[model samples]
Target: MDSPNVLLLLTTLSLTVSSAISGSVVEDLANLQPPSDFNTTIMKNCQHNPSLRYCNSSSVDLKEIFRFTIVASHLCNESKNPNCVHSFDKIDLRNRPKIAPLYLSYSFFWKYCPSTIFSIDLSNTSLKGSFPTEVLCCAQIQALDLSLNGLAGEFPIESFSPLTNLTSLNLSYNYFSESKISDSRFFKRFNASSFIHSGLISYQECFKESTSLTPSMLRAATNGFSRKNQIVRSEGVEIYKGTLRDGTEVRIEVYRDCISREKRQEFVEECKVLVELRHKNLVQVLGWCSNRNKRAIVTEWTDGETIEMWLSDSAPPWKLRLKILSGVVAGMLYLQENWPEVVSDIRIDSVLLTDNHEPLLSRFQVGDRYRNSKKIHWFGIFLLEIITNRRSQEFERGEAGFIEHVRENYPENLHEVIDARMKLPENIFDQAKHGIELGLMCTDQSISKHPGLDQISHMINKVYESCLELAPQNHKRSHGDGEEQQDDQSKQQKTTPERSETGDTVYNITCSSQWIESAPVVLKMTSSRY
Candidate 1:
């Protein structure tokens, strides 16, 4: 009997040992998987409540973060508390989990934390469904962003009435053209751009030439076309800063009297192109007024100055500079893929900076389709200019031109090529160097050698990620040490570049029956020569 009991104990011990080994092997396999895959699996088989997750308070990963009560109270817009506020924090979860579906049903928050919800941002999340009306239950909701989703069908206009406290609502880039609001007052809260491309506004309402404006209205808005109102006076066009009787700020561009019939036709083509193109980065065309004696195009007033002017006055941090360049890249991607003609005249002056430092492209013109080399070369030069803070024209006369200068001068540490005004950390210098290398790639003289817009966008995005990863502790300002690096708030004026002999820098905007007409002048340069 004793021998049989001992045998049974030995057998059970052996089985327990085997189970332990198997468990170890499974954990090792999991560790080998990529973080994204691991997170995906976690999301698929979450043991806890799948709809919501509170941080593990005991975990050191979020030690610097205030306790949930504090964080939740602030998000809920309760009065500030000393325990909730902190002057410093050091939590950096570089490899955090990514949840699938990339969205939370509005009802989930309503059921779990209704009063706690203050903001919901799900832009570019690949969400596909009807808009979540359950969000109305979150009474304290201040900001809601559902842009860049696959959501279709008409929105229930009446549902928005309960969201009276909502300060910001962004529903752009969704399929809701057939959507209608019973109350015009709801429409009053948002800009026209929100409804653009959604088909809420008719095509005729978008690009109706002759803004129903007599010459008198233009003159009246521009103080009788006075010199004070003339913001930009280029060879082919004069831009006037004006305010309409309805309090809308506008930039009125009046073409020169010497505009030929062919150029007028070209302007129409450009306008047709511009009317169809609606992007946040492009300076949007509101309407145009055409008369026998005078022709004018109206654009929304860009609140900030041209990039050239802003760079001159303020030395924005390297991170902000990368953000500005990224915006320009987005504009470039849209122009390259969508426009019928090549953007051969893409120069630094074409970019405008808004009050919040957002970049906008202006002075759009359509040229030959095959001006790829010229376009790429100028884009490269533009990148170089951003890095070196030197004007494109300045690089022409020197023996070591822009391309040569970058290669020779900053070969070891490309961040050395950066403008002295921006004070960034050494850790993010790698990101700055990556941007410089990309600029060189853009300038590749081989007509077919340059990276496509998609590739360029990807590379820029990587650089942006790198910049974002640099911890706040790493940053050191050029002026006063610490957080108060930016204080310059002076606004600069925007302008178009001087006209070139090749073509009119500013062209007339109109729509014509014939799309094609003349051959465009092309500038060819070899990227290999650099």
Candidate 2:
């Protein structure tokens, strides 16, 4: 299971699949494995159920560096030729999904190209031929690893300027004279260490020259750092998905060894801390794996909408907006009142809403090492996002973010940020405005003055509670203006007018006393008397 090492995993999974299908009604696949192709090596673990086929797989191999080498041999059929150029616009490698070349192996896969892949890995390949100079075309190249290769000659500066987007450049372990590139005008702007491990100011390059043209061979040859999977799962946890002796579907997110030891340990500590909280508003962290070899987090994946998607997509109506914000406040309050030590990093993407609109907060604090003003900024930003439906990053008018809306016309008509689908009840219009004012206050540029998570919760509670007390129904439109909202109240008034067990009338406000033939005033009931 380590790095999935496809050559080995294919054999193992095939046998497992064959055995699994025979034991239970569920069918497994060992015979369905496909022959390896230049694009991918698919070893199936398929379970076909008339309508569909399900399969799970781990990626095998990744280009430590993706680049090109100069070919001394004519086998170097230079298709782009004499040019020795390969376009990133041509490497269609990611489409295969299941296949990725590791280290120098990626240097072997330059046939299909991509137009915009900057970060490439071509380490650990003894690719001969001079370096393919044309890959400099990838203007967006940032991190490139071409370490541990057989490359020589003066490093060219013209080949690098096109890749101005680059930040981390690695060209260690090569044949070039260290002093040459160190003093060369082209390599001077970058750090001396970027050309490490050689007599020449060395840089990594592609394994193959143009004997056969490929997409990314050149890019990998330049930047000499490995581009392996950096996102890791937690440690000590096994990814279980079969039967558990019982009939239930086993589910788990196992940790992978991609994260640093420290972060993994922090993740584990956070999991341990979160396990102590029993609140329903906070997501339950069932368990976590924190062993040094591997690390990962295991929390239930709620099958509903995320707050960002909910707002940006299928936008719910105005009433629903209040309801959602209310749920968000209730959850935050529960966390602060009970688990303030751990809950932090409250941002729009971090908060989720269930199908019923109950909000659940995630990515809370587990370890003390990684919490601070960022947390306040995050929580305040979350509230600001809910109020403005604009990301906090856009707060300044520079990017036109949520707060920018208020900045353009605040204390004047702050309703612009409110969801167009929602309505402001007559009485709580002020409260809604007040809440927005608080959001504007909370999302201030001066981090020092921004409200804390608890204070944000308080502001929302105060604004909403006061608003509800005054308007109860949440809006103030009459039959002509608020007829749509009053429909719900009208039903409630007629059905259980007073919440009576038998559904009795709650009020006897005589129309005769209020209505005159010439001027019948609509009874503006201040609050729900029923």
lDDT by residue (1-530, candidate 2, tens digit) is: 22221222223423343344432211222233333341232222122111111122133322210111111111112111121122221221211112222212323223212223545655444544456454454456666656556777666655676666677666766676444444555455544344446445322322111022111321222121123312223444344322211121212344445778777656756665665554435665544445555444445446666788898887554445555666666666666666667655456676777765667776676444444455554555565566556665654643336556665655444455554444555444444444554554444443233445565554454444333224245334621232333334233322111223533322212211111122222212122223
Scanning candidate 1 in windows of ten residues, the lowest lDDT window is 507-516
List runs of model 2 lying over 4 Å from the truth: 1-255, 259-264, 291-293, 369-376, 393-401, 447-455, 462-530
Q: Quantify all predictions' global Cα lDDT against the true fold.
A: 0.54, 0.43
Report the lDDT tens digits of candidate 1 across residue range 248-294.
Answer: 68899887675666766666666656656677678877666665556
**Candidate No. with top lDDT:** 1
Error of 2 at 256 (Å): 2.8
Compute the lDDT of residue 41 as modeled in candidate 1.
28
- C-alpha RMSD of each candidate structure in angstroms: 16.5, 25.8
Write down the TM-score for model 2.
0.39
